[model samples]
Target chain A: MEKTWNNKAWFMVLPVLVLVAFSAVIPLMTVVNYSVQDTFGNNEFFWAGTDWFLDVLESDRFWDALTRNLIFSAIILAIEIPLGIVIALNMPKKGIGVPICLVLMALPLLIPWNVVGTIWQVFGRVDIGLLGRTLATLGINYNYVQNPLDAWVTLIIMDVWHWTSLVVLLCYAGLVSIPDAYYQAAKIDGASRWSVFRYIQLPKMKRVLLIAFLLRFMDSFMIYTEPFVVTGGGPGNSTTFLSIDLVKMAIGQFDLGPAAALSIIYFLIILLLSWIFYTVMTTSDAQG
Target chain B: MDFSWMAWTLPTALFFLAIALMLVGMGVWEYVSPGGNPRVGVLRFETTRGDRLFVSLLGSAFIHLAWLGLVGANLWWALALSAIYAIGVFRYV
Candidate 1:
């Protein structure tokens, strides 16, 4: 069948394009403007060509935050991806329980980022917080505000609790989309549960899993609000991902030039990593 | 100190009027395009459950504001309430 191309479809996309340009592109341009210029308190900008960028590149703080972000993203991907798949596998494929299970899994992803932090903050409190009080009662001495390890653990747990559902949902979508004929063929061939998952389910889930990985990686690398809300990036900067550090530099210290440069660099890193992820996943899909 | 009734009554009435405006706007939209919701596109992208979830999030933002006004910025309570609202939306909406 020959397909007719309709140019008017572009008009349909115009509203979203306008919205995105305003919300995303304009802010980005402003950031770029700030990055390339020096600003004083009176909202006056002076041209400072490459000076702030050079300073940011040379700064140890930027490097440390970048490393922390990379490590956190890696840790989250490692934990959540496998755990999500396992949870999805365990969930009932068909029954009255399916919607119930799905709803329960989706509960965490609904909470706002700051609120996720707050929930963990109170939950980890030694007084009225459940986890903290229980730990203290058992002589575990857990305090996120005072201890770096505790803060890191609390942040990771909070993120996993909140985001693992996303992974599960993606994986579930993949699993459910597989044809019944494929399962029937696998069953007729006397395939085991492990074999069925590996040969049939995993392959079907590859695309959504790639998407899940990318989304999780990008979000985890840019994690700010939850950690900021929970620990305020304290306990000796243990939970200070790049986003938190950027906000701290820009909003807290009001170092516009350096912060702008850092922000651009951070944005570029995310863009680059996402591009790389997309390339690798697509290439693998083509090969497979 | 005797509080003035007009101060409370006027603000409350105006607040409700603003809410009524949003409801009327939604009703007009539903009336105009009954088959396809005008705001469906905004809801469909980003998340799977679509625009209903987004609408629920919008509603919860109002709830959060009300909580802040009434309960002195209890973050955990607000968070929990919002989460419950989202969950309710997932099932019912």
Candidate 2:
């Protein structure tokens, strides 16, 4: 398609640019300012160089949080992708079932973030919550607050409950769009079910799958509120992800300099990973 | 999150003023670039610029909601995810 290649196109993007400048650029500049400068009472400020950055880099707490973040993200992607595909495949493709399935899937997504966290937090309480009570009734010990393993388990379950619908919805969209002719041709060729899916459905779903993967990865890596609400990064900081740690530093303890430095590093990591995802997905899309 | 800044800071007021100017600027851009050929993308039909923008905005909303659901409330992750979504929209809608 021939585009006009007009310098006027810049004007079309102007609104987004302005919005980003306010929402992103300004906040980022503030963070950057805080990173290099130290403030005391009455807003007195002095240059601090990279001292804060160095401190954060050397801290074991930072390293531990980063590791926890990576592990959680890895676990989520591994489970959600395959599980979502399976659930999407099994969902009714037609009739009243389709809308029902869609509505059910979308319900979890409509809930607010903190509400989801609160729901799970109460839902997992060993003494009163359904999950906790059921486990106790069965003579099983499950205390997310006191047990590191249980805290990890509860957090993972809460995340899965909340996010698996996204993968299902995206996959369902891909699945529903697969033309009937593809399946008819597969049937005519007497292709095995696995072969049919492998050659047709899976290939057709690649774009959405790429989207699901990258979206999940970025979200999981930066996860905070749910775990913060659920475990409070508890059981001795075992579940403390980077975002939580950053908040604790910046807001909890009011360590602006180190927190700002950490925030920059955190932003850079997500940017790097997202860039890699975009490049790989787009190049593969082009080749395909 | 706080709108109090708008009342206190010149920079915040400038942001809103910039947004108003941008809306008018975009109308001019459309007028100058009379006809734009719709591009074929991941969607079944070809999409014009507005179509692409709409899809991305909707897609990015879900991405953010899902992030808050499964992950947390860190805006940086949302920004990164939005970046990927914008690339996808531009590349394939």
Candidate 3:
């Protein structure tokens, strides 16, 4: 349906504009200012052109963190999407179990990020945490605090636990919205379960799955809290993603210019990559 | 009555209480208004005011978590992000 010209509708959006101006525009301006100028002591800044940006781009540390971020997001999307789909497929469709399962799934998503981090932190402690104690009892020297591999494993597991529900919920929403007639038609055609899913369910769920994929990608790429809490971006910077590294620079080291440049670069990367992904996927989605 | 185990400050309690009251107020508003006339937003899906509210709350929590982890302990940015998220949800989600 085409919307009629209504200049009055702009009035409805004024509040949003105001909100964005203060919340997004102002902070972004601060970052932009920081990205350009070198800061000394006592509220003094010197013009520093593209020096910070070039420095950040040249830094091996920045590149390493970016690589780590890419790898982590790639792994997360690879695991969570299929796993969530499988779980959503197996979930009860029409019973008391639906609500129970949904609530159980949603519980993790509702927990505060730091709280989730803290929960995993304590839960994986070698001395007091249950998982660590059990692993030790089973003769596995699993120490997340000391082992980079263990720290990565813990971070991945922590993320999966915290976020897989989002994918499941979106997929489930798509699943439940499929009309009963579609199933009946498939049954009349003697379609197998896999065939039904492929022809009917999967196609129907395309939009939501795209949403799931994008949401997961964005969230994982920006993941900071759980890993920061679990490993403090260590086993010696091994678990440090770009966001974690950026925080350490901007906040921990108080390096404003380089941090701001890194942040702008980071944001641009996400924007460019997401734009490409959306266009490619949506074109395929539209055709399929 | 020794309530030391509560683990929350007075301000935090009041904040929560205010939230509860706001939710109650929203409930009453919903009942009075009845049909929400769900409209298509940026998602191209028709969503009610309640759906927007739910989305904003969930998005706000994530924003807060991200801010806590990546930014400083200060909550001003989170509040800003939450406000933006709320507006986005109402306008788009």
Candidate 4:
């Protein structure tokens, strides 16, 4: 096949360019502007240079929030990936059970983020909530409000319940797409179940697994709403991830300069990490 | 267009302009040479010229930020370091 160059094709992309310029570029420019400037109040501004960026990078508060974010993301990925694969492997391949399982897996994902947070917030109350009350009855001191460990556990469990379905759905899609021929050949060779999975299934699911991993990593890193609604970032600053910290700086304390600087640094960190993940995964995939 | 609301200043404007020029220069280079001729670099992955340029720019941003954090507000040294980094990325990365 041959291709023809058509300059008119750019016209089709004009709308999207315009939209992005307004939506993403404009706001980003404003953030950059705010990042380098300081204001006392009421439109009076002074050129502060890179002071805010320096301040953010030097601050213990910013580092603590970042560490919390990294730990939370790491824990989420550790729990969700294997659990999702297991669930996907057990899912029915054919018949009415397939749709039922799919719908069940998708239900949590369909719920709005804030609503999910609210549900978990109420669901973990010692006074009336199910899990909290049960723990109390069992002579366990389970209070997410007071105990940092309990808060972390509740957040992790809440996240697993909410997001593990996405990974399962992705892996299931990968599983179902495998031709029956591979399974048949494995059976003919007298391969055990583990070998069949290890050799055939895992390889096919690699691409989807990568997608699920990256999606979960990014989402968990940027997690704010659920933790915010549930614990309100504390008895202290225990659950304050980067986004929560940014919001507190920007809106709560109205520290625009530092907040803007933090925003740029945060965005850059995600971009750099994601790029590394994509490069490393694809490179290994090519070699393997 | 009423652009005053954004509170743009001279240094910031120059910074953005430099970025825009770099992008335009890259686009022109691509137009002149076509395929960027990707090569495996010291990092053990394949990268095209544009990819190298991106890597350089991103690395420079971090270098500048790190310098700002570790050192003082005098950014001339940071700028020099970033320039050297960009050169290194172009040459080897």
Candidate 5:
């Protein structure tokens, strides 16, 4: 049967489109304006053409920050996806345990971004914080402010704690939606636990997993608040991801042109990556 | 790193106002629907998932506020709160 596509749904989406344009589009255009023009203190702009973009692209600092962003995102995806699935699998399928797991998973997500950073900041302080104090007593020289390795580890740990639950929630939703009949059939066919997960649950969870991956990737890539609060893009710029660098340029140095160009480039990269992910997931859905 | 004074003001004022408003709103709602259970009313306020989610959210927010007051925004506090809230939901709801 041919389904009639409802045009009325567009109205429902119109509000969101307007909100997004206000929040995303105008700021983007402003950035585009800044990227191509040099401005003095009096709000005057002169044509700089692609000078800022070229400067940004050719800089070693930009490359380093980009590399850090890519590596951080890669690490987060690798760790969170499997860990989240395992957590979802172990959660109680029914009865008392269901809400327990869910609320625990949700708590980190609910805390404000700045608060998470502050919490980690204090928690990692060697003098007053628990983790740092314990590590110090054990004779580990573990100051994140001084050591690049410590800074990286602390940042990674903070992100994992903050975001792993999102993945878990998505995977759990996918898991719970599966029909009991599928499991029953697997049992009847004498399918092993691994086989059940591999052939049925994993495939069933593809869409949600894709969503989890995309959300996590985008969020990790754009992460600024927590790390900024914790490290301030210091320890000799070791933990300075692209977002942090952009903020430093725009706010710290007030270099409007290059910062604007960098932001546009950053937005484009995220958009491209997201499109690729959508295409891959949808095409796989068609095949499956 | 020195603790900025701004964090002190923003979170406290915002948290208190939010909680006060919620409680006042609930009080008014209960006064209008005198026969309805307040706890259940609080729980089932939202239609999509019912009052359970509402109650859970309230409880979690309270816990978070209390943590901020006591521990002053430490990472462990966030981690602990997350664990507490997640457990509370599974067990209570």
Candidate 6:
């Protein structure tokens, strides 16, 4: 059958275009407008060129927050990807157990991010929280409120508890899509368990793994609400990722120009890094 | 028509206009010459004309940003560097 190019087909896409314009483009334009201007608090503004971008780029505070964000994202990807794969591998393939496992895995991801943070905030309290009191009873000086390391540990664990389920579900979906024929063939070949996984399972899961990696990376990189609620970027700016810093600059201090510039820079960094990750992963996937 | 609430400035508006123009131009170019003829280059991944354009634009942004960060606020040299980078991307990438 031959395909016809109809101009009316564009009408189908018009709704999405309008929605995107309203949701993304308008807000982004407002940010861009603020980025290169100085405001004197009377709704009066003046052109400032790239001065704010320069200031944000030069500021140690901005750099420190960016560094923390990158490190946090790296640690998350490191922990979640493998942990999700392991959990997915262990998940029962069929019967009543499958639905139960899936529902259990999905429960954490269904919770709101702020709610997850709030849960951890109370759950890590030394006086009342289970984990904190247990550690305290074991002679561990665990105080997320007072110690930076403890704060980081709590945040990372909370994030893992919250988001690892997403990876598990994606990987499990990928794993379940594999047919019985492949396994039968592997068994006939008398392949070792590791060999079967390396050759059959890993290759099958590559696409979902890539999706999981990108989603996790982007989400972890822009993480704000969870850490903000849990730590409030406190213990003296220890957990202040880029979003938290941008908020503090924009709303907290009312430095609209610099904050807007920082937002642009932050968005660009994520775009650039995600593109790089996509390119690299897909390239490797094509080759191997 | 009342963009006063947005606090739009001349330079910023012009900047957005230029970007919109580029996107329109790209659309026109694609309509005229479809397929884009993806090819592998220095990056070792297949990319079409639009991909190269995106890469160049993204690179140019970073170059300008780095210039602002490392050197002074004068952006003439940064613009020059970005133009060269765009040409290189179109040619090679």
Best by DockQ: 6
What TM-score should be assigned to candidate 5? 0.73
TM-score of 6: 0.98
Chain A TM-scores, per candidate, are 0.96, 0.96, 0.97, 0.96, 0.95, 0.98
**Model 2 per-residue lDDT tens digits across residues A1-288:** 886777777799999989998899778766766776666535555677556766776689988999999899999999999999999999999899999999999999899878999999999898889999999999999999999999999999888999999999999999999999999999999999899889999988999999999999999999988999898889899999999999999889988878988897788778767756765776677667
In model 1, what lDDT does residue A92 have?
A: 93
Can you write out model 5's per-residue Cα lDDT over A1-288, one digit (the tens) per residue? 999878587699999989997898556556766776777656566777656766776689888999999999999999999999999988889998898889999999999999999999999999999999999999999999999999999999999999999999999999999999999999999999999999998998899999999999999999999999999997999999999999899988999889987886787677667756765676677677
- TM-score of model 3 vs. true structure: 0.75
lDDT of each: 0.79, 0.81, 0.84, 0.92, 0.79, 0.93
Each model's fnat?
A: 0.00, 0.00, 0.00, 0.57, 0.00, 0.79
Per-residue lDDT over A149-257 for candidate 3, one digit per residue giving the tens place of the 0 to 100 score: 9999999999999999999999999999999999999999999999999999999889999999999999999999889988999999899999999999988999988
What DockQ does each candidate score versus the true complex, computed on alpha carbons? 0.01, 0.04, 0.02, 0.72, 0.01, 0.81
Q: Would you list the clashing residue pairs of candidate 2?
A: none
C-alpha TM-scores of all predictions: 0.74, 0.75, 0.75, 0.97, 0.73, 0.98
**Residues A159-209 of candidate 1: C-alpha lDDT, one tens digit per residue:** 899999999999999999999999999989999999999989999999999
Alpha-carbon DockQ of candidate 6? 0.81
lDDT of 4 by residue, A159-266 (tens): 999999999999999999999999999999999999988999999998999999899999999999999999989969999999999999999999999999999999
| Residue A64 miss distance in model 5 (angstroms) | 0.4
Which regions of candidate 2 are displaced past 4 Å? A1-5, B1-93
| Best lDDT among the predictions, by candidate number | 6
Better of 1 and 2 by TM-score: 2
- State the lDDT of candidate 5 residue by residue for B4-82, as single tens digits: 3112233334645665686677667656775334232222221222243454554564464345445554446665775
Clashes in predicted model 6: 0
Off by over 4 Å in 3: A1-3, B1-93
